[model samples]
Target: MSKLAWLNGLPLEEAKAEFLRCCGSTRWAEAMARARPFKTDTAVYSEAGWLWSQTSTEDWREAMAHHPRIGDVSKLRERFKASGAWSEQEQKGVQGAGEDVLQGLADGNREYEERFGFIFLICATGKSAQEILEQLRERIKNPPALELRIAAGEQAQITRIRLEKLLTSP
Candidate 1:
């Protein structure tokens, strides 16, 4: 879909404010602000792409603090629901795969957390269990700097999806 129309009607200030709330780290906040006036949805996503590229490992870790471990995602969903940022539909979208996949995510999550002290962060919307698993497996051996970059990229994807939802709202 064209994000151009969505951009035109967006309350830029309000949208930025909400984006800031969802993602509060300084660089991410700045990137969202700077990404306004996107000519297309793809362009907006491009900003996310850039944000991940430019982010430092420290900043990525800071951003990850906003999310929970992958397997523990249910609690994150509950938190989002309670905060009114998530509806049933959105929650379901986040949980886009099977329990077995979640179980794998949990195992991966545990190993990752043990290795890194932070949750395994990925942008789960629209991804299948196998796809996510592949990523998780590949990411397991990433060096700290590389993993942070990859994780931040995934976070940026999630941020963009959530931001798009705001534009689609009444």
Candidate 2:
């Protein structure tokens, strides 16, 4: 019994709940649940990509609301408990940084949110805290529209990672 097999076999409500854990947008989760019985892993990933593209800015913002600010480890662990250990794992690179680096990330996150009206989202899986901060500093220079698109793209990458985890988890 593979994870995808388990996912494909889940009841509709349960499937929706699981998908919600992957991406916080209700629309994405609902669309994923309705697109069930995916025969292949690629099909699942394809459906997720298509649905995310079709989603509106409102839906993207909804998903963004689910994440903590970058470097906010306490909030990541305590507030995002619904996502369990995944958030903490994804942000592992920032776990034990010097206060100066953490403070830089924190300040950059604030400036980014003030500019773009959402959290600074990045695929932080393997990025170091300094590298993440550098990316944020550079990205903050983009115009609002461009930055929003970049954030959404980063969220899409995160969605893909979570989906892969779902399929691979025992």
Candidate 3:
């Protein structure tokens, strides 16, 4: 059966678990499960976007907690074991990076978190390590208010991609 059909048919508790795996927000997952029986893949994505927009700063932070630090290969393998496959796929760009670039990313991640009180977030799906590093360098200059919004936007993009993945998976 198709994934969309599978999602449409799952029980509420099971569906909430699946959505949590995709987005990592209990509220978002519960809201999605309550909005069930989605008629199409687009409908699922639409609802995801809407629900995310309705979420709070704390909710965004909760979702962000689900991701491992970028360039942190050990955490990607161990800390994020629940989302390890997806995280690895999303960060394919970092896999073959040079050590200097990796170290730069690690250092930048530290500085970003220290400055903003949260991890640096980027979509990172198709970006190269150098490209991601450049983005990090630039975004780190932004003030906290602006950077939090930027991070939330990136998380929204990630949620949309994961939602698409969920519906397309077998």
Best by lDDT: 2
Evaluated against the true structure, the overall lDDT of model 1 is 0.65
C-alpha local distance difference test of each model: 0.65, 0.91, 0.89
Give the TM-score ranking, best first. Answer: 2, 3, 1
Which pairs clash in the backbone of model 3?
A: none
Q: Can you write out model 3's per-residue Cα lDDT over 1-170, one digit (the tens) per residue?
A: 88988988999999998898778788998999999889889899999999989998888888888888888766686787667778888899998999999999999999999999889999999999999999999999999999989999999898888888887766
Q: Which ten residues in a row have the lowest lDDT in candidate 2?
A: 76-85
Off-target runs (Cα >4 Å) in candidate 1 are 1-16, 21-24, 30-53, 81-100
Candidate 3 lDDT at 74 equals 62
> lDDT ranking from best to worst?
2, 3, 1
TM-score to native of every candidate shown: 0.66, 0.96, 0.95
Residue pairs clashing, model 2: none
Regarding lDDT, does 1 or 2 come out ahead?
2
The sequence of per-residue lDDT tens digits that candidate 2 reaches over residues 45-155 is 999999999999899999999988888888876888777478888889998998999999988998888888999999899999999999999999999888888889999
Supply candidate 3's per-residue lDDT for 103: 93
